[model samples]
Target: MSRPLDKAGWQAMADTLTARLETRAYIDDRFVDAAGGETFETINPATGEVLARVASCDQADAELAVAHARRAFDGGEWSRLAPTRRKRVLLRLAELMEAHRDELALLDTLDMGKPITSALGDMAGAIGAMRHQAESIDKLYGEVAPTGEEALALVLREPIGVVASIVPWNFPMMMTAWKIAPALAAGNSVILKPSEKSPLSALRLAALAQEAGLPRGVLQVLPGFGHTVGKALALSMDVDCLAFTGSTAVGKQLMQYAGQSNLKRVYLECGGKSPNLVFADCRNLAQVAHHAAEAIFHNQGEVCIAGSRLLVENSVREAFIEHLLAAAESMQPGDPLDPSSFMGAIVDATQHRRILDFIRQGQEEGGRLRAGGEALDGPGLFIQPTVFDGVTEDMTIGREEIFGPVLSVFGFDSEEQAIALANDSVYGLAAGVWSQDVDRIMRVSRRLQSGQVFVNNWAGGDQSVPFGGVKQSGNGRDKSHHSLAEYTELKSVWIALN
Candidate 1:
């Protein structure tokens, strides 16, 4: 394990972030105030301190930004630029991100309470996502359909004008990259609304994008609450699309906002209660146990695709529980700035309390607390890496998305039973099946109802994978070439040439 940054080093990083806050939101390639100079203070969850005062942009500011984006799109300087030119700007943005990786990682850690090591990796992931989309632009080709000799049919993809991206706070920088990269690559104007809880990095990213030669008004950042600014974007008639990543309820509301306004295309990547199934034939129980614990405890279990529900065959239930508990004990929550910390503080006091409420609900409903269930004795917003065994299918913990460091264990007798339990959810975002038997892995993987499945592993994939969910988990996908389609519209044109 690597040593954590010392106190002085952390303080220096904090000072740098504070200086960034002096000029909060980035709109139209400039650091500016909200419409009325309204501002909000974003707190650091790890230290319970004020990290920065960000612009509290609302409907008026959102409208202004949307107008800017609409004008940029209509002007055609950015939206109609050659693919190579757009690609160059995007590559430069990625380069700038790499150059400031350390500062960006530190900003993420202080803003969202993620471990410093994990945050550094997230910065790299963001850079990669940007580069992937940038490099893909020039390779995308239109198609010519086979028509009779008298006629020719062409299928071309065109940008959908102004795109609004409303992202969550859990993976702020990465989520920003996911939406911004594809939208900009497709030659659309973008307005980014970062969650008020963690807006520092997005603000910094907008500034870097401008420095990379993105035309003014082509990309903007609005730092505000979802209910106010998010609603405005969804309700804007001039906006052509809205891409969101958040809760199912909010995603639904955004869809309605689109309907009420211009009927804009809305793409959502929402909630999940993904399952991790372990059969009795698994080759190694210890390795499975270790990864199983990580599937839930990593990122403090704030991931939308976290393996919150663990299903084990009855024959190996006891052994699996033993090893899992041992693994869970090692993932104690610590200071997020520590490079060696496995888990960090919860996002804020509200989220910390919400997780505690779910923990209480788990106990009151009937699940037995096998490992951790209490808050730590500290000033920062911290919670234990909680695990519950003997959890029933109907228990609150088993059915709901806790979005915290809590795991619920259940037992299954047969393959059919495991598949049934896994599919019985409002979400079908992802699932994992662990077994050494190749046939069994294939059989179970085929039966699992999820967008992504992992066999003999958990949460393993790259930016190339098409990621999204089914049922109530929301619609559309993010990442990969598939995501680029979300920001573009297909048109079929037929011409008769004599």
Candidate 2:
């Protein structure tokens, strides 16, 4: 349901949002400064208005945060706390987040230009995931290895030391929770560095964490450019592990930084140009068209797992295009604060230009522009939900990760041809297949080189499943029990009890 444009309700919500933004960065369980009170202006992507001046934390601030985290981890006040105590704190944090859901959702929409409805959904997902991680702690048990008559061996899962989480601007609150909740639940101290474009929610989450009775330095939020603070966290010798979600280029650089300083564990969930494959056997053209539209245009098409490439069978090409165009019209960009908006503004002017540049490059490379192509004439950085048909596997848009609301459609004749075209990209993050034939689904699902594949849907799964990529998309998963392995070190303790 669209949030009613109730003037009084909106005005009150806006006032509450402004109050939340009064303080920017949260460090060591307190709202503080960046060495000299230096701050950067945060823009409201929905309206191109200045929201607030946030602390522009740099290497110095990162160093201070790392120091505090190291102390907290070494002191055992938090890191060595009983699992039940830690779980209680995390569960409490989840409760606090739910209580302030409206404030957090508004903060996300104002800071990152996501539709209010989408932001609320993301907030709810974050809360549920955090609660799940908290609940899983007591149930987790280590193993006992079978040894011969010589010795008794016990396998233990131990928390890695301080964890530095670097997250991107898109889905700020939820991504932050994806990294922090697991690390905290695993008993590791964490330092979070959120994107400069959307730091408000992360800062607010830090306050909530403290309110939940988490020890000082257990969780700290730093807001700044990636080069200074993010680099500092990556290179810090005291940091035991680094979890990041962003571009493949930055993820690679962080790996280098890890190697250069200390061989700390680095887990990255990077870019994607996911392919959505449709076969002629799928008779539901209308449903397919709708899912295809939502796969790309959702969140202004600013998702890592966005189905940016659409590969359809040649038999259904013309009919699919017609329905797809009809579906695209419903996803035009609108005011992000309005819950009715299905598509919101691009994260910022810089990203908007990048998307447009990619569109022009797609045209230059001979891809046919089917639907929306240009940015809308409006106040915010809103682009039309674009679709390019007759796309070949060789086109620039077909191979590269646009990370926008642009979908490139290609037609293939046979099952093998479709698999070949879908697997042609350098990325193998995600892919989706639509068909009723069990044989085709099994064959394609096996041969398709990707971390995750959807049978009837595109880009969906619960927190129970692992999420990550292969090849240039980067390594390691984010959700599920698999992610806990990234934050903990397995140890084998042996005893000569014989």
Candidate 3:
């Protein structure tokens, strides 16, 4: 399918795909139902309609999937394959994803209510991650350690047998690809548990993997809730490693589950209330405001690294807010199927209500609502792009991770104060500083306790950069070659030359 030129063309494509959406879980290279025959309806947040009745996998399904993954890994059909052979298979999977880009984009937009345009844009990141990891497979090399004259030491990186990846709903295909591509590229059997809110893309991708020559049981997708299928996978004794991208609370829970089971290795990329700082010395306040609005409102602010907290220099705070309001006007919520829409509905009613509640709390705490503060009328779980000025560091809306299109503005007089405010939150995922002063940028970027810091920009990075968080946000990295470390184990072999 080609790229749709307009809203109608995209809508027509979406209608066609919705009529025949895949709902079955993919296991052992085939689509199947839950062993208990239980099912759950996945709702389209855009229209408040049921898109499909997906298999609601539970402990039994988790156990079955793990057994298959274990067998596949132990059987060496995939885990023992040559790196070049595995690379070819992964590259083929990437090609299939590119061929089916439109279908996969529609599945995510319909399931999670992101704008079709945004959903389509996500495909580049998803496919690029796969291709990058695939190309890196054979290129990765084991290292030799400096040793005494009579001894030779070798340090090797090997796949951790069975990996369970739990991805969130916000960026379904992209997050799934980020977690699984490297794990699969490392020659580990992966069992993916996508958030039940949006599982269509993951299921579809699993089928594509099989068609791309992935061995049976090498890759599986289970569509279900975190407490059941997610918990089961984290606690499975046969599962050697677990990788997750979601809320900080759930990330912590999975860590506990890992400890209770076989002490499996767990890697987490969790939540953030990331801050964006704007100094009076910024080269362009108008440009900074435009990017700042995008920093918080893009994808309905569902981004874990969304710059929800905006700390501006006190001298230019008022002017920046005015420019920010104008930028926010262009991001009003609309139909996800429409290519012209900039913002889409929240993932579900629960998330919609949570965002609204946070807005109300901001008001009650004496924070002034500078722009939108109410949910838009009509169907779907839509909330207008909201901004709250006069937000204090201690305010509820300023400190917590709302994970919505809500921006809390704060004023600081000094660079030290800006750094202090940005690092005050429990999260340290990502941060941004908009200033032309090189010294100030250097000073603030070093002081801010975030995993990634952008100077004179909002959110701009590619697959080559390592991404993750520090403090409570989460541990471990995703993307770049650093990610492969999460899915692999290190072993040392020493040989005596005597």
Best by lDDT: 3
Best TM-score goes to which candidate? 3
Q: What residue runs in model 1 are displaced by over 4 Å at the alpha carbon?
A: 1-8
lDDT of 2 by residue, 401-426 (tens): 88889999999999989998988988
Q: Arrange candidates by TM-score, descending.
A: 3, 1, 2
- Winner on lDDT between 2 and 3 is 3
lDDT of 1 by residue, 1-498 (tens): 445567467767777667755446677778888988888888889888887678999999999999988989999999999989999999999999998887888888899999988888888889999999999888888899998899999999999999999999999999999999999999999999999988989888887898899998999999999989889999999999999999999999999999999999999999999999999999889989999999999999999999999999999999999999999999999988777789998999999999999999999999999989988887898898999999988999999999999999999998999999999999999999998889988898888888889888887778888789888887889889999878889999999989
Task: Give candidate 2's TM-score.
Answer: 0.97
Tens digits of lDDT, candidate 3, 125-198: 99999999999888888999999899999999899999999999999999999999999999999999999999
TM-scores vs. true structure, each candidate? 0.98, 0.97, 0.99
In model 3, which regions exceed 4 Å deviation?
1-3
List per-prediction Cα lDDT, in the order shown.
0.91, 0.89, 0.92
Clashes of 1: 0
Superposition-based RMSD of candidate 3 using all C-alpha atoms, in angstroms: 1.0
Which 10 consecutive positions of candidate 2 have the poorest summed lDDT?
2-11
- How far residue 203's Cα lies from its native spot in candidate 2, in Å, is 0.5
